[model samples]
Target chain A: MFAKRHVISMREFSREEIDSVLDLAESLEPYARGGGCDALSGKILALLFFEPSTRTRLSFETAMMRLGGKTLSLGPTEGSAMAKGESLADTIRVIGAYADALVIRHPKEGSARLASQFSPVPVLNAGDGAGHHPTQTLLDLYTIRKESRLEDLRIALVGDLKYGRTVHSLAYALALYGADITLVSPQTLEMPDRIKADLAGKGTMVRETHALEDVLGEVDVLYITRIQKERFPDPYEYQKVAKSYRIGAESLAGARDRLIIMHPLPRVDEIAPEVDETRHAVYFRQSFYGVPVRMALLKMLIGDRLE
Target chain B: MNDGEMKLRVTPIGNGTVIDHIPAGQALNVLKILGIDRTTQATISLLMNVSSRRSGRKDIVKVEDRELKEEEVNKISLIAPGATINIIRDRRVVDKYTVDMPDLIVGVLRCPNPSCISNTNEPINSRFIVKSKNPVILRCVYCEQAIAENIADYLI
Candidate 1:
């Protein structure tokens, strides 16, 4: 078997591979409940983030610590040889020599892919521009499975699907397992046609709706995403679309008891804070479980023997 | 014969291959596309910055003892979509090959979309379903980002 060397995008994993990770995460809940540390003792994880982050960087660091491993966090784009004009290839080559494994975040569209090409170690993408985030999608999948059943589930993705890298990656993983996906957003914020066509090709039920209320009672999983200001050029455009897509308990009154609300966080109001109190609120758990799921991910990635 | 020894005479293509009306400035894009840039395997003759009756200034590459296949003709259509190709057999022109728009291209143009699904990790090969040919539009099989005609490149 080829070494599982890179995780630049979620689209790289097959349905079977994703299922395997979910199964590992299922068992990981015990570790989470028991509060054990040292699953990956003494291992070193290199976090090379050129862009600013909140949830992803901290989540991976927490995952490493909980596993009894060490982490080396590099600050955003300022401190490294990057400021001195070292090429991305040279940076990865130098980093690969020191770190056992590498996690990278860069502003270039294919930065993770480029890192994987040069780095000798496993290169995990923390986030790549307005592109894909494979690990985030994995936790999101695990969250959906834990909060509610995943197979054939009705999943409605709301907010900025056009610029939401999380939604783009998540929608494909949802389709890989055969979910009925309803993409609800403003016309300009609508799901890109490429993803729509892919779902259509797979015969996955997809609909574009302007109002979330129309689909509120109908969906099993309300996967909400925020308008990423960083993904847009103009702040004014971001401000205009931000108001229309908030998820609160008022909208959830008609939703199913089994319903789950999720967002790739550091949210800017697409999801109301009040929704976090509801039983349907799984975003925090989703965000929290990222630590353990990623623990399993890093362990699986680095080939550590697990009992 | 290879290298300079394998050269195409400047004489008018007596009834053979009609590499008609190549863009004078870009005969090199066509030559590079044909995999001739570094090869010393064949005798090469090129006409550059020449006046084309069809295109204002033109570039041409006439390779001796080389014939393009049907699939290759399709590729020629893409690189210089306006350029023409001709068949040469026994020093005689047999059939003229005209450039045509491609509906589903196998492997020539690269998808221009940086966020395209084919640009991702899954073990699956990349694919683009053609939406239009005129202003070529392609929908990536994975991410579903539609890359415009020139910006998106497609492969088999």
Candidate 2:
């Protein structure tokens, strides 16, 4: 059912499909870690990053390499036709001709969805401007499934809930798995009303709070996101909230023994370095899981042709 | 006044279309959807808050020498879901039917989101998935932005 499909939004995925991807990722962990397979041997995966990204781009390349597939990249937009005012659709069309599937990260919201409509091959949205990053959500669910349990899981999504697409996608997917959600963010950066309404419509039990201390002891996973200064209209608001959202060693003192902290990283100190050595820090492992999760996604999307 | 006298308030069109049962206060919007401006060539009659047997009050539009296209009929459905179209030819009703609201409305309404791909110069027409018909809530296919209010303003 996944053949030649566009992975554009988490809303597009059913709970069963999400679990299936996570299950496939678990099975492919050995191949991802060991690094050799002929599953997608003859396929070509294209990487297009209109926005700068490290983990998403590399992990996709890593996933493709592990599956024994060749990968090509449109490295920097400055070096590509996009710098010369080539439209996203035009670029996607050109790239789609050369690859089996396309992994795109654009600063514009819905650009990935738009690219999918134009491209000949399947489009995997690495990240769009506060729109979606389904693979990240998938890998996140995978990490939570590995470290904790998804069934009746209590998760607190902290920091930048307003603009952080990671939490937005994760909240919906987590609800699908029947996890109760605690949204922890400053008033200005609280989760959007539309998303909360959507979750409520799905009958997901969600609690909203400004204090992380309120839910820390109860939640199985503490998901912290970087308060993106780039997304804020005013730098003062960013500065005010960024200073208040940090988590250090003392922050976890009241937390449960099995409480796992996850972040979609490029962290500018939302999570202090002191927390990294602790078993609670599953983010690095979370980042590593991006490989197998993406490998599963890539295989699911385009591997049928390889058969 | 009697029902026949009430119907005589708006003159009949010889060969055009009559839109009836529009929700009161939406006659201007229906006219806008039909692209009726001061420079419009077609002779038009608009009646707002007229008495209706089904609805308490309604609006009606009668256009002379002009028939609405399928696109216009669909746009009218967005603003006036209960409105019916009567095709007039030689002062007689040739065809009559209530406008059907399509599940997917394409290219007629613009997405309110400024950042939506449809709003950009992408060579793609805007598309919306009708989530609710009574209240006319539409979710943009490209950006998934749900537009619930003032939908007429977003009409392309």
**What local lDDT score does residue A117 receive in model 2, on the 0 to 100 scale?**
92
In angstroms, give how far residue B143 of model 1 lies from its true place.
11
| Model 1 Cα lDDT, one tens digit per residue, A1-307 | 2236677788678888888877876777666655657767777889998888878888888777766788997766777787887777788888888877899887756667767877888889887777778899999988888888788789899888887868878888888888888888877778877678767776676887988888988888988877667765778867776766777768778998788888777777888888878888887788887876887778777755233
lDDT of 1 by residue, B30-105 (tens): 6655656674566666777665556667666676667766565555554466777777777777777666655655
Instruction: Report, for candidate 2, the interface RMSD.
Output: 1.1
Candidate 2 on A146-181: residue-level lDDT in tens?
A: 999999899999998887867888998888877889
Over 4 Å off, model 1: A1-3, A33-37, A228-241, A304-307, B1-28, B32-60, B63-148, B151-156
Evaluate all candidate structures by whole-model CA lDDT and list the values in order. 0.72, 0.88
